[model samples]
Target chain A: MARVLTIGEPMGLMVATEPKALKDVTTFRRYVCGAEVNFAVGMSRLGHETAYISRVGNDPFGQHILDFLAEQHISTDYVTLDDVNRTGMQLKAKTLEGDPEVVNFRRFTAFSYMEPSVVDTVQWESYDHLHVTGIPPALSETCRETSIAMMKAAKAHGVQVSFDTNLRPALWPSEDVMRKNINYLASLADIVLPGLGEGKILTGFETPEEIADFYLKQGAKAVIVKLGTKGAYVKTTDETFYAPAYIVENVVDTVGAGDGFAVGTISGRLEGLSWSEAVRRGAAIGALQVQVESDNEGLPTLEQLVAYQNSAKLSE
Target chain B: MARVLTIGEPMGLMVATEPKALKDVTTFRRYVCGAEVNFAVGMSRLGHETAYISRVGNDPFGQHILDFLAEQHISTDYVTLDDVNRTGMQLKAKTLEGDPEVVNFRRFTAFSYMEPSVVDTVQWESYDHLHVTGIPPALSETCRETSIAMMKAAKAHGVQVSFDTNLRPALWPSEDVMRKNINYLASLADIVLPGLGEGKILTGFETPEEIADFYLKQGAKAVIVKLGTKGAYVKTTDETFYAPAYIVENVVDTVGAGDGFAVGTISGRLEGLSWSEAVRRGAAIGALQVQVESDNEGLPTLEQLVAYQNSAKLSE
Candidate 1:
């Protein structure tokens, strides 16, 4: 099995227990989640060796997240506790219509204080794949430097790099800065993934083909464009095609669909699948992810994925 | 020492950790507080036997509040756990410019479901005073009926009734309902306490004496109007006077000043202090309460109160 290492922030989520405005909600169920952590968890469940690195506060919420990661079998060798800054938290108001409304309380958190010294001592040679996201670099200037240090170390070790353009505009100083920094990171990744909406903003491209071409021209080996339920557009130096979606009968939540897709794509590649076949796996995982309430609950195991694929072929 | 029984909702409070807007804050320090509970806690600290009656959700926050009250030596004999509905919570954003912005998440909570049946079993005769507030009656139709039932039982037992017009306009269905219900409750109480602002809205009286006369005509034995740092105005059938405030150089928080005043007034009356002397005690507590950062942290014990009064005399 291939080993993948991801670095980002994990926040304590307080999800509303009922369908109401946040101001009217009195109860919440707590959970630990983040885009990169969700990706790592999805990979680990598929029998891949996954590791996560981040800083958490010396608080109960921090302890909870660490315990959750350990239970999920994600290695926490580089994880550390921060005494001065507390962990970040989010309040999500559950709704009957559309997506839930979320209020993020992540400013001045332990994750934002990540410094270059964190990655300087890491043994990058042990990890086969370095997975990163756009969020970490946007947290703070020091975190930006740390992200570059980690990516440069992975590159020096000749490891494959995968980057997800999970853009959060509120975390950045400006759209211009985010675009410049995200494009720089995407250029460094062998496989670059961006949602259709994020592509349009970052590359000024209106279509999936154009967006993929923009990233490919920047020296990326392949670019995959996420198109929600319509599926994904995959492009390499020599080929390009669209992967159709697996139609889900019930969509309970759509929070971590992209992370599931990333997990499938990365793991499928490590298992020696062709680029087009990997994109198909990504599409299937994304479809499965939206069928469950909790963010990453519907992410499939190896047996579950094979069973699901076989059933879909039979129905077809 | 006299016995005081208070019945109302207790809430889990999430106070922001720094000076910031509600949307910007990411950390909160949790506390348990309520209007009647605050009054009861204040009385309990003064060596009075205080009992609280309410319904709390069978949840961690509810349990925490119960444990906190027990630690403070307030009897929770009549408190029951609600199986279905959860306890209420409020988020307070810390600020340096003014009173913190608060958002209530108390709708459809256990306290709102308190019925007349809760009051039916209470031994109202054993209590020397029944402390109630305008807030509980405004929660739900059942709570309104419960408040009336409690006041009627206290009247039947010849127990002194202390009612605070702790106005929360948003909790009521309409202003008319709140005004009518509050006025009716005030007429039934031996002591009616209203802040100057609440009195203006409830009675449309321009001055404290006029406000006191309005309550006195409605069969109230005494009326006390809180006039902030200017002190309190007290009026009985035969006498009326203004108790000037003790000048405090620093005012950290003013959220629970009125609750402190009620505590001092109720306890002072129990201690056989004259009406004017009780009003002075009310003013002293109000002055002291605003000198601390926490909501009710500045509320003092009897010895502390005596020491404070002596110091104020020396300073003057």
Candidate 2:
């Protein structure tokens, strides 16, 4: 099995069970959430040897996250327990359709204390792929330096890098700083994933082709532009194509669709599938995520993925 | 020493160390805080046998607060450890003058699950006084019932009751409801402590004597009105007078000054001090609370209080 590695902050998520504004929501159902959390769980479900790295506080939320990761079969050997800082928490308001309203209390959390020392312990040579997002750089100066260090180490060890340009303007000090740092990291990855909106801001481009061309010129092997309901567009030195989006009649929550897409694409490529086939799987998984509620719960196993693909073929 | 009992939700307080708004602040110092927390700690410091009743979660914040209560020598025999619901939390911004900005996340907490059964378990006959606030009734229906039940039990066992109209308008559904419930609770107490603004809204009276007469007619033996810098105005069935405020040159925070005032007044009476002398102690403690950053850190021990009184006498 291909070993995949990803890192980011995992926060305690308090999901409102009832449909109400956050101020009016009295009771909530707690869950574990993060961008990298979804990607790791998705990779694990597809039979990949996925390992996650991060720091958690000596709090109940931290303990709960560790137990959850263990249950999902993701290795937590690299996770460190911090005694001083606290685990981050977020409260989400429930909605019937579209994205839920979320307020994150993640500033100065335990994860923000992550430094370059943790990256020094990682066995980069043993991993086939490394997954990362723009979030770590936005956390703290140390986290930014460490994220860049990890990516550089991956390249030196012949490990394939996949970077997701997940823009969080609120977490960044300024737009100029966020764009500069995010683009630099994306240029270091073999495959870069950016939503249409993120692409426009990061590259100052009007179209998906222009956005893809901007990253491809920076030495990226391939750049994928997510086009919402229109699916995704990809551009490489050799070829370019579009992966049509699957029709999801009822879109429940669209929070983790990007991470799911990353999971399907990365897992498909690791299975020795063609680039077009990998992009198709990414589209299928993105469709699956919007139909369910929680972040990684909708991720399909290898058997389930094959079943879903076969059924889609029959319908077509 | 007199046995003093009090009940309410104790929360994990994260106080911003820097003079920035909560959104701009990164690091915060954690502390155990609540209305009753301050009162209990104050009473314990004065060598009173103080006991606190409430429910806390199985989370880290809950455990931390329990440890803190134990450190202050407040009896936790009646505090229940809830496994399901979580302990509430609040984040306060640092300010140089007046009250600090506070954001509370206390809805549907572990303490909200408190029922009348908890009141039934209390050894009412052994306690000399029961302290309560308007906050408990605003928590939930079960908590309101429990609070009312505790007060009824205190009266039946000849235990004196002191009600603090610490108005929390945001926690209530409406102002009318708050007035109705708080006034009902105040009428049942031997002494009622209401801030000037609270007295205005609750009784629609412009003068302290008029507000005092309102509660006095409703069966309250004494009514104490907190008049901010003007100190306090007290009207018992027998006497009426004003306790002038102490000169506090530098005011840091005024969040828990009322609780400190309540602690001084209650503890003084338990020591068999005259009403005027007790109110003077209340004014002194309130002055001290404004000089410190944390809620209960400024609350003086018996020794410190005596020393402060002696020093103030020398200065005067």
Candidate 3:
């Protein structure tokens, strides 16, 4: 099993419990969520030894996130309890159709104030792979430095790195800065994962092939493009292929599909699967994730994945 | 001027910004509100020297409440910060009419877990009066004990006490227990304030006169029943009076109308106004409170109260 470390911010989420507008609804259910944490939980559920590294406030919400991570069997050795700022929070409105409206209140939060010194303390050599996202670097200058420090440390320790361009425009000062910083971090990873839409914005590439070639030319060994329901496109140097998406009757939520795709591709690669097989696993997991409500609840175990793959082939 | 001290749990309120349900709302505005805090703010704004006593989490929401109280000139001398528990919070829905729907998340909160020791530190003799609501004692056994202790301390020190039967049925274990405990606390006060509905439930009386006599027999010097838009009913030993509510073009919210009445009656009495004039002021303030959106925003200053009373009289 691969020992994976994922770094980013986890926030307390207040999701509307009904189908009414946020203003008209009176009930909310709390949950813990973050892109990197979601990826860690997905990887851990697939039998990978995953660790989550982040900082949270010394408050109840922070305690909740820590408890949730522990329950998911993700190591919390590198998590820090910061008293200077409160943990971040997000309020999600559950719409009848379309993506849920999310209002984030994370400015000057404990996670945004994370220091590079915290990153320097982690034992990078113990991890086989490291996963990072664009959200943390957009939080604050301190968080940006911490993200770079973590990526550089993992690279120095010979740990493979996976970078997801999960772009958030509102968190950063300017689009120029976001583009510059995210591109710099992408160049540091061995595997660069970006959705087709994010790839078009980040690389100014109109097609999947051009987008894959753009990231691969920038020191990345491979580029995987998430194409929503169509599937995932994997390109590694001289080879390129498409993995068709599994057919599902219902799509409960599509918020975490990309994260699930990343989990499948990274864990499959770690398990010595071929590039096309890894992309197929990514497509399968992405299809599964969209069928569930929460961000990471539908992630599959080893047996579930194998069964799902065989069933998909039989249906075809 | 009479120095007033009000005690209760202050919660961070997340209010939806639009007319949508809680599930469909994309934006929320944060505010610090609680019955006692609203009363304190009202009294302070009306030029009374007001102090507030409670426990809150050592978090940002708690900090916001403290800063807001300070800005309103309410003393925070007896406020305690607890690290072990989180501050209370409530999600309020915006309805087109009547009262709004509120979902409370206050279980095991810092204020609910407050110890009686915090109450013992307050210098009761320095304040001319103490104000409390039914919400705090219903929160937990510890809060109940603390409420009883503070009332007893105020009584022993010869400071007048105002008790508002701000009953929240969801906070109590049973209606019988709430009636028993709230009645016991009411007996310890010189002035008892109860809404017509709450009075009917607590005293088992159908009319304002019978309700006033019920509390008057329990050692209370005066009883005032809030009669909604109709006005206020006040009764003392041998005298009874009804003050008519002022007419307003719009009724923005009714959540804090009862608290506004308390502030008016108590502060008017402290200023040596006649019993009838105090009741009239209470009715006037109650009328004003229903014309604003926030809990205490419509609470008027001394000059504003005079102007409103004059305009109301001119209209009549």
Which candidate should be chosen as best, given TM-score against the real structure? 3
* DockQ, candidate no. 3: 0.04
**TM-score of chain B as predicted in candidate 3:** 0.97
Compute the TM-score of each model's chain A versus the native chain A and list the values: 0.96, 0.97, 0.96
Please state the error at residue B227 of candidate 2 in Å. Answer: 0.9
Cα-based RMSD of the predictions, in order? 16.8, 18.7, 13.9
| Candidates 2 and 3 compared by lDDT, better number | 2
lDDT of 1 by residue, B17-59 (tens): 6776543454566677688888988899899999999999866
Q: Ten residues in a row with the worst lDDT in model 3 chain A?
A: A20-29
Specify the highest-DockQ model's number: 3
Clashing pairs in 1: none
lDDT of 1 at A251: 68
Q: Write the per-residue lDDT of candidate 1 for residues A3-90, one digit (tens) a residue.
A: 9999999987776667866645655666777888899888999999999989988665677788889989999989999875667766
User: What interface RMSD, in Å and to 1 decimal, does model 2 have?
Assistant: 15.2
Specify the highest-lDDT model's number: 2
Pitting candidate 1 against candidate 3, the one with the higher lDDT is 3
